[model samples]
Target: MTEPGGGGRTGWVAPLCWSAVALEGFDLVVLGVVLPSLLDEPAWGLTPATASLVSTAGLLGVMVGALSAGPLADLLGRRRAMLATVVSFSVLTLLCAVATGPWTFGALRFLAGLGLGGVLPVALAMVNEYGRSGRGGSATTALMTGYHVGAVATSLLGILLIPVWGWRAMFVAGALPALVLVPLLARYLPDSRPQPPPATGAARSRNPVAQLVRDGYLRSSVAFWVASFMGLLLVYGLNTWLPEIMRAAGYGLGAALAQLLVLNIGAIAGLLVAGRVADRTGVRAATPAWFAGGALFLALLAVPLPGAGIYLSVLLAGVFVFSAQVLVYAHVSQHYPDHARASALGAASGIGRLGAISGPLLGGGLLSAGLAYPWGFFAFAAVAALGAVAVLAVPRAVPARAR
Candidate 1:
């Protein structure tokens, strides 16, 4: 099939979209990286409570942005929307470096969250549309690897830059990539064709949100939302609290931290494997299987294992846990019509942010009660099981046009 842009240069889409996603991933972890330094500064008078408020504010903005960006993308072209979001967030993130107080910092974070939230759905939509036919699963999973790459890079940067330069430098570094990324997007990103008007007067009056429920999509839409919620819950819950939870389970701090790294490494491996399998066997089969594998591994972590056994379990858990969510995204991209694709993706992502917020709270609650070890694993296992069941409810068949 011909590429989205002429002259067979569609290669640019994946790299460009991957870079955009990496920026979002950088933002995702930057707060965690900088929070310690912020607390150390006596002048800011930053408290844990205020820090929580700032974090929550950014997430809430992301949720709102995710909810809004899809329909906006469907109405406006993807290239335009993508450029606007990137510029908006980059400028706001740069400003975060210079904020005077907690309130100012948090306000900037919230503003940046709006752009960060918009990036994923739009990028996913762009890659899916531009990619070769029948490879949506591979294309999406490949694009998402940039997320982990960005995250890992930020962690390393935090270790290196924070001690030498300070926390403010991190935000400036995060924003600097946009200087290169935005211009390339403007010059190379192809504009998707405008969505045609709905046929009937009634259809024309119905909004994109309403259309998700009106057609044969009601069941699948709800299923995707449920699956997304559970998927992100496992993701955020584990990432936020795994080290502490392992420490609670009697592991040393070094080992616990090492396991966290193992988990993400497993995630990258999983993305690589899951996408190809999904493309060959179909996302309908692969998504639930991955979730089930995640459930099994999470449950095994509850059992006391030898040192290597524990690392192996965490690694396997990471493999299934992370990619399972991305497969849900692959399914959404393959199932929805061109008009509703971005909207559906945005809704799933927006709703999933609630799970992201809830995951850390759940982990914190479990830790406070001294139940974070076995109970935490058990709880995450149950959530993974639910994700599997939720994906099963989506019909096996997608529309021919979507295929």
Candidate 2:
């Protein structure tokens, strides 16, 4: 039988942790889906450059949040840290609906990004703690499925609500879950075990970057960061530009959007399959292979093929593209000690945010240059290949219990 605080509780822990990530996913993609609506508003007067700036600002804020939250969670406890982040982002997102101009909107997005950034690491830590030994990969995969689920929900919202209620309504809708989950988290969530109670009762020093560079960990930390950078670049870039890329490949709008749906469906399936596969094999064994497959499939993304062939390739690419990066996060949890778990996750995510920032901008540049489809697929393929190498070289840093 499972103890009260044992891994069995991961069922609840994983879902609760996902609530925050779900909110992030919802907020992240909803902006893209709603951009057309924003452009139609004369009051906003948003140029493409101005709109891009707003996105950049939000991404910068997310990187800051991801980098900073590690230590804070280390000091404050994961549950409380996550709750604070959720509340902060939720309120700020609501405030976004009321913003009057481009500047205000961009500023609000940046502020919201802070909350968005921090919540992910904290939630990740919670799931890792409750996860069974040797099951860290599966645990993280399960939690991150929430991200794709959130994205799926936003797409549905765009179809159902955007036509009637409009874009601002999307932000308002994003706020509801935070309000609902905040109280539930406060009531039911358990604290992560403290990190050795901060030596001699002195104030805690919780810098993830600094700690990661310390004795015996520097090489692994750098490897993971490199892997994260490439993995997320492929993820964000593909999601941002897939429709445009597909269109350039001669698919109609209906087909392009259908590809998006297909991609995410494959993503959901990949997450479930990856968790099970990684649990049976090893995260170390599975991640590099997945990234390699992602690279191969992405390379074929823009090649003209028969309808059935295109569908199968896109589905396969989605499976590997989304899940390969997730496996990276899973590996981080398994490799790190409990005390540094959140920090490790935070650092990987924080660094990965750089790629997130670059992905869309690069895709847009390619589109403007009229090299849209082939360039995007080719670039993503290269990044995926790099990810394969970076992850393949990861030393057997798995923790004793995790192994």
Candidate 3:
């Protein structure tokens, strides 16, 4: 890693990147939060079927955006790519407030997701590139904490504002990140990726995507994608279904929602702890353990535990579920060369979007088809177990300095 100039510039990277991702989290959860309000308005005529389609549309856009971003961020500067995406997302988000119908709202969300999807890989790449030596894993994990924080904030806003000011106003509030965060990123976010002198001729011009699978990296690259897929599947599934599953398991609606809150609280705590541990013990070592622990906690949720036991299990579940996925990102950033990091992370996440899209659908199907509360946990556990095996399968390679 290139030596950073001072603490001030280094400090801003995390917070600024975190804030950008937080906006993604906010936009992500706000749609779910406001869906009920949209449904309530007969004028909008949004049935569950149509709403599901709308949600999938946005995710489809995310997958497309994520896959496309790697090349741009690699060819362009990370800061410039991130800036363009953040601006587009913020503007589109503001436009969401003015959407009059399901089609229009869904179209806006799909467009905004283009921006949202691009930001994460670039942000992860930025954090990884700027991080100290072996701490790339830790720094990337630390940056992801912003995503969950944004989710929590959106939840609170939905509870407070969606009831009073209505759904459109809540979407309007999503635009504040642009006004507040864009300036900080524009001013301080480094245009430089940890430089180590320039390459010569064709080496400098090779595409990031093609670079990822070259030089005996194909196996590890594939493994990271598989691991990410399973991890994200678990994450999106639980986040979408946890409340309803808890409600089915006999908790009241309020308590079920509160348990979801506890889960995110645990996720935040896990990020703090996991990043440090991964840095200390290597992401390759820590990731499997995390996935195994996540699977175990999920299985624990399947048993008919007491209320406190349930809450504790949920908290522990959060601890492993989300960060395990992030460690995959960490693993990518750590394993690949600087030139390949953004593309590697982007491809992994972009492919993993399939799982993200499937997760909610899987949960909804389980919930609708019966055996939701009990069986859903088991399914998540199974997926997490697979994630463990996938990560363990990655062939260790010497880090390259192609950049």
Candidate 4:
């Protein structure tokens, strides 16, 4: 069957998918934005340890959502899955505004995380399926720029809203966009056609996860998982704690939050650049190079710099750090067959959430020890280097048809 919006009429696909990803991006940085305020609220009794636990709870939910959503989307249809996820998360996020305690808030976050986690792979698969032929790299990165666009907006909103309206306002604001977004999705988003049956009868019966490790795909699958873990470690660790880290480094809260804003702004710029470069140089070469650049910039963040110098450093770090993770998704989409593409992306994202969980814990631990500044940057830099090395192991080849 011909896919809906195929034949190069995918205008709706990009905007709807991009908007879905933007919501996920809002969740990505919202907690970090409100974290400092939460800590200051005496009634909640939140400490670094508890905050990390809350963050972990949310990430754990995301991991489960990602792992299950891929197969579910493959079975039920992407349009239905996307709409369900958006509604589920938006309602849960709105409830977060009324959470009575940290545990209650954490529970809501975990519940909302389930929907947030599912959005990425599902939206990604849809975009790739309907995207311009042979521009998978650009297509993937372009969609992801919405991720940072939302994040950048959240950071700015936090700065403006949190102080005046309080921390709960951020959650309320995060969910409100979905009201407009969901209607657009339900009205315009088209369901993707199911993948054709496998060539062999035996292969046809096998599930998406099994197809990942079979047929000479084990090495690439394993490599993608490892690289994704490290990439997300950097992405989540910094987004969740960079403002606090900057605070620990002696900057005021406003300046620290501004740094977070700068970081994602740089991420938007990086995503735009990385896509074109990856498309031109080949994702295989470009992915590793971006990770390596991320490592270098992350390590540079350890150095103490003057005001302008520090913002520039954070911007550079954002440029390389965030897009490095998205490139992994681009690479996976190009390497895998359509039959198992969402499954592969989901598995990679789900496994990467483990690193996402660890990222906050790592930062929380460092902050608790009063070593968040130099040490956190060093630790994050090492993870980026590992990401570079892991992707290097995934043999330099895209499927013939994919290319």
lDDT by candidate, in order shown: 0.89, 0.83, 0.84, 0.87
Winner by lDDT between candidate 3 and candidate 1: 1
lDDT string for model 1 (162-259, tens) is 99999999999999999999989887887764464456445542356665675567888999999999999999999999999999999999999999
- Which candidate would rank higher by lDDT, 3 or 4? 4
Provide the lDDT at 290 for model 4.
95
A best-first ranking of the candidates according to their lDDT comes to 1, 4, 3, 2
Residue-level lDDT of model 4, residues 25-104, one tens digit each, is: 88877887899999999999999889978988898999999988887877667888898899999999999999999999
Q: What is the C-alpha RMSD of each candidate to the true structure, in Å?
A: 2.4, 3.5, 2.8, 3.3
lDDT of 2 by residue, 1-403 (tens): 1123222234567778888789988977877877888888898899888988988999989999998898788766777788789999999999988888889999999999999999888888888787787788888888888887898799888888888988888889899887788877776677664543244332232344455665356677888899999888888888888988998888899999888878888899899999889989989899999999999999998688885898889999999989999999888877776677788889999999998887877888899999887877888898899998998777776433222
Q: Which candidate comes out best when scored by lDDT? A: 1
Name the weakest run of 10 consecutive residues (lDDT summed) in model 4: 1-10
Give each model's clash number: 0, 0, 0, 0
Instruction: List candidate 4 stretches off by more than 4 Å.
Output: 5-9, 36-43, 159-166, 204-206, 243-260, 303-311, 366-375, 397-403
Off by over 4 Å in 3: 1-8, 193-205, 398-403
Arrange candidates, best TM-score first.
Answer: 1, 3, 2, 4
Best by TM-score: 1
lDDT of 4 at 305: 90
Please state the error at residue 197 of candidate 3 in Å.
9.7
